[model samples]
Target chain A: MNEQEAAALFGALSNDDRLRVIRALVRAGPDGLAAGEIAEAIGASPSRASFHLSTLSEAGFVHAERQARSLRYRVDFDRIGALMRFLLEECCAGHPDLRSCCGS
Target chain B: MNEQEAAALFGALSNDDRLRVIRALVRAGPDGLAAGEIAEAIGASPSRASFHLSTLSEAGFVHAERQARSLRYRVDFDRIGALMRFLLEECCAGHPDLRSCCGS
Candidate 1:
């Protein structure tokens, strides 16, 4: 991904609450989770969860879909992989010798 | 990595200049590049590179080794992996169907 988008993704992750929210989503997995469920999992108020989810959606790290009235949020692996690749490209300064360890 | 360190790493990456600095370092590889060299590569002033490098090292995303007078910077893959994993765990919030795409 381009640097600007990368910055947005990073910015979305930079906050403590948001990171926790994403981690909760990761644990919740392919099923993803509803807004209230995620907030409760991360110990956030409903409003706070909504705010962080908006940030994640804006950054393209997570996608939100409305299931009934509840919003189901899921991780966006494409963007996650893009980030991993961007940071790990030559990764650790070309420890190309160590690339075997990276794919895990 | 724990959430706190993850937050710092994300914060360091949130800026555009720092991301460029890292991309340059990633490109430069295990040889990593000297401070002056990295600055020139990313079109930043030497001092700016120094500040940015300090943030990266502090956040544990990059490492700096002194080669006589100049310090060389390299990506820290372990931390990068940690961040990627932290975000990708059940990843995309549980799309086991998509596991194939993640390890790449």
Candidate 2:
């Protein structure tokens, strides 16, 4: 993603419920979790959880699939990695000398 | 930063000008920048830049120093690093197998 896209993605992450919901999906792995499961994990009202998940999906941070009547959400690692790298290249104050600044 | 603190910091980064201003300060290293220099670096109007910098400073992403009429801004790498690590630990969907998810 470019700078503008990164900004938009970060803007989406600015919310507490959204950030919690995304992180919960990240922990759930590629298989993901259904809407109810997400709400349980994040301890939010189902309506609130669904709302946050929608925001994450719209930002391209997560992918949702219909399994039965439930919507399952999975982490979009590609976009997450892209964001990490973009921040490293464009926003990291991380110094090469410090080596602590960049790379995992 | 805790969850709430991380949320707040990310909230500050949600804006384009503020993100640009913070990133510029990150690239500037510990010495930071005067208000005018920051404006020039980001191609923002002085007044606009000052406004953005104030936002950053208030968010604790930057620290300002006054030298005569000029105010210098520095990246609070501690906070930047904190935000990164928090995102990794709290938000990374990364697996140990996919070490790419965290650290850097």
Per-candidate DockQ vs. reference: 0.47, 0.50
Q: For residues B1-104, could you state the per-residue lDDT of candidate 2 as single tens digits?
A: 56677777777877777777877777777788888988998898999998888878888878888888888888776666667667765567335432464334
For candidate 2, the TM-score of chain A alone versus the native chain A is 0.83
| Candidate 1 CAPRI-style tier | acceptable
Candidate 2 reaches a DockQ of 0.50
Interface RMSD in angstroms for candidate 1:
3.5
Model 1 ranges off by over 4 Å:
A90-98, B90-99
Q: What is the TM-score of chain A in candidate 1?
A: 0.83
Q: What is the TM-score (0 to 1) of candidate 1?
A: 0.81
For residue B41, what is the lDDT in candidate 1? Answer: 85
lDDT (0-100) at residue A7 of candidate 2?
80
Span of 10 residues, lowest total lDDT, candidate 2 chain B: B93-102
- The TM-score between candidate 2 and the true structure equals 0.86
What local lDDT score does residue B72 receive in model 1, on the 0 to 100 scale? 82
* lDDT of candidate 2 over A1-104, digit per residue (tens): 56577888888788877777877777777789999999998899999988888888888888889999999989876676667666665666344432263335
Q: Highest lDDT, which number?
A: 2
Model 1, B1-104: lDDT tens digits are 66767777788888888888877776776798899998898788989988988998888878888899988888776676667665555224434433345444
Model 1 CA lDDT for position A52 = 86
- Model 1, A1-104: lDDT tens digits are 67777777788788888878877777776889998998898888899888988988887878988899888998776776666565555323434433444444
